[model samples]
Target: MAFITKTHQEEALAALQDLVAIPSVLDESQAKPGQPFGPECLRALEHTLALCESLGLRTFKDPEGYYGYAEVGQGEELFGILCHLDVVPAVGQTGWKTEPFTPVVTDETIIGRGTQDDKGPTIAALYGVKALLDAKVTFNQRVRFIFGTDEENLWRCINRYNEKEEMITAGFVPDSKFPLTFAEKGLLQVYFEGPGSDQLALQAGGSLNVVPDHAEYQGSEAAAVASELKKLGYDFQQQGEGIAVAGKSVHSKLAPQGVNAISRLAEALVNTGEFANPILEIVGNVIKEDATGESLVGLFTDEVSGSMTLNVANITITPESSRVGLDIRYPVTLEKETLVKALGEVCAEYGVTYREHDYIAPLYVPLDSELIVTLLGTYRELTGDMTEPFVNGGATFARAMNNCVAFGAMFVDTPDYLHQANEQWPLASLYQVMEIYAETIYRICCK
Candidate 1:
């Protein structure tokens, strides 16, 4: 019993290598100018669209600066395979054996920024669509492979696409943990402003969506917080009264709870009374981490998507106010107003203000749906592995469609370096994923 694909693996691998060579880190500086994101990310998108155009496929770039689409076949029902090209910032000094952006192939793994996070998968999806087109598979649905640009920082790309285009039927996104992802917890990235006296200097945590790997504090009184962190076995350095604490970086924040460095640092600051701001007192009184905040929906625990998760991404202090930007993934059943009420209470009590800068509702696709059955069956047929669809705490472009689920690309048994240093995907796995996607596209479109 062997599963071999007629799809061109060499072409897929070559495309993946070419995509890996591009450094598509979102440029905050260029976000306002011509490219909006940056030259590299825009190049990544253009490269994808050009590849699609080479296949004689019709391409469309939505009005919003974040999305591009390639359409093939002509039919009433629309099927989509959603993916992104943008990647998080990767630095060379981040303890990587090879350059973070420049991908290097080991025995089985392809190491680079978007290797596993997105770029590799995006290429795989493109290859899959190419296979279907080359095979002359005709069906009643128009298949669109959407490559988004802002999946890392924001979802402006998909938002703009959905606003102008028709809704998709059922499709899969090759992001996040695989087999199948049935549920994605609701997400809210916010800025929590509070009072600060400039007595404590705090720094660490790279982004809201990712767990912070490095954080530090400055000040003599910070010793208490540093000492406590040291007691907790955190890799911390004390320099001129400032302390740097290091923790593990993980995606799907709710799945990996204790690895959040920023949360741990904030806890230490609160416990040591290092934050003289009244907001600190209020947060300590009301939002008691996993305890008092249980009243919130996802703040509790659920059998499906687990409990509420929080990652305090960044903290800023000024003469007028102090703030902590937080990324929270709550449960879908939880009411936004209820959580806002609780936060508002704490903010009012502490003379602080709360604002939700980003709100993406949890995406829940029924496991029993035809789309799920078809996708799951196709995966099992290819891999001969019986696995159930699961949930993810990380958001994906699948949520942009009316009926779509993240199918493959990332797996449960593999090491997923999504949004981390030296992100990579096994080359063998990449080939298999391309074949799976090819079959999935053909079956959905030609059946």
Candidate 2:
């Protein structure tokens, strides 16, 4: 079943490098009606679709340009390999040995922004189907590789696909780690605002899906803020008119594992004699070191999806507006309304208003479902890994539809560098991923 060859491996790596070279981060300024996400994303989408088309797979580029797909074989049932071409921004991240958009290859590894998070797996899946096609295997089902553009933000691509394309009978997203991920926590992003302040002016963080790594404040009280941060034993540098604090960034799903610079800066700023917005006050004192909702008075965990994690994703204060962004991942069993109600009560006490910016209800598939059993069984037969399907805090396209779960391209030894600087993945492991996807596709589609 290991049908991938040396040429297959080389081609997969080359395609991955090509994809990583595109800075396909979301850019609305350059977006037009036909190209909904932006020019770069549209380029990535077209590039991937064209690559698949060259391999003799039936491909379709969406007319509106929100999504595209490549398909192989013909059958009534559709099996999907979910993937996204767009990546997160790499503009302000630090500690890169090579350019984030430039793929730097070593004998054993490749380093790039989208290498591990998605682009690597995407190429693997693409060639996985190609290898099976080369084998001339008759497929009992049609396997489609769905390419999305706005996965890191609003999921407009997948939404448009659902509206216009045929739904998959079953699918697996290659975004998570090996074995499988059967449950994903509910994701809720909130925007809290209060009366504007002429005195406070600050902006921090990038996307709500990533923990902010750096935050800076420029004000008359910069030196005071520096003193406070120093007393609190936080790492910061104070320049002439501003103080900047640095922290570790990780995926928002793993907020507990990251050091949120936004929350730290807010804490230091308020303690250093600067006027604090009520939202800032809450972040500084209440959610100080706890990523769980205990500080927000809404910490609730269930057995299904583990802990309720919260992240101080971003902060912005202007003369006319004061706002803070909170990224919350809650237990799958918890309803969105229940969580929002509890959070709104807390915000009201601080004289701040709470509104939902984005919401994706939790996804859970039973272990006995045909889709899970098939994927889990394929993984077991190939690797002899007895690991069971598990739940996670991260969100994937697996959560977007029914009978879908995140099945891997990452193995047990693969390092996680999603949404971080110097993201890299081992070449040997990635080739193995291609081999696995090939077999899995064969089993699900052909045999």
| TM-score against truth, every candidate | 0.74, 0.72
Query: What's the residue-level lDDT of 172 in candidate 1?
Result: 77
Candidate 1: C-alpha lDDT: 0.72
User: Per-residue lDDT for 410 in model 1?
Assistant: 76
Local accuracy of candidate 2 as per-residue lDDT tens digits, 286-314? 88868887878656898877889999888
Please list the Cα RMSD from the true structure of every candidate, rounded to 1 decimal place.
5.6, 5.8
Q: Mind giving the per-residue lDDT tens digits that candidate 1 earns over 1-447?
A: 212354466777777778878888888676654476777878888888888898768998754457788988888888888889888878744767788766788788888878988888878777777777677678568888888888887677788777777778777788876688878877777777766666655545556767666766666777697777766565667767677666677653642454555555656677785567664443333333342135322245567766777665666555566777667777656766777777777667567878888887777777778898888888899888776777773567777776788887876688857677778888888888878887887777887
User: How does residue 405 of candidate 1 score in lDDT?
Assistant: 82
How much is the lDDT of residue 137 in candidate 1?
70
Candidate 1 worst ten-residue window by lDDT? 289-298
Best by lDDT: 2
Q: What does the lDDT read for residue 157 in candidate 2?
A: 94
lDDT of each: 0.72, 0.88
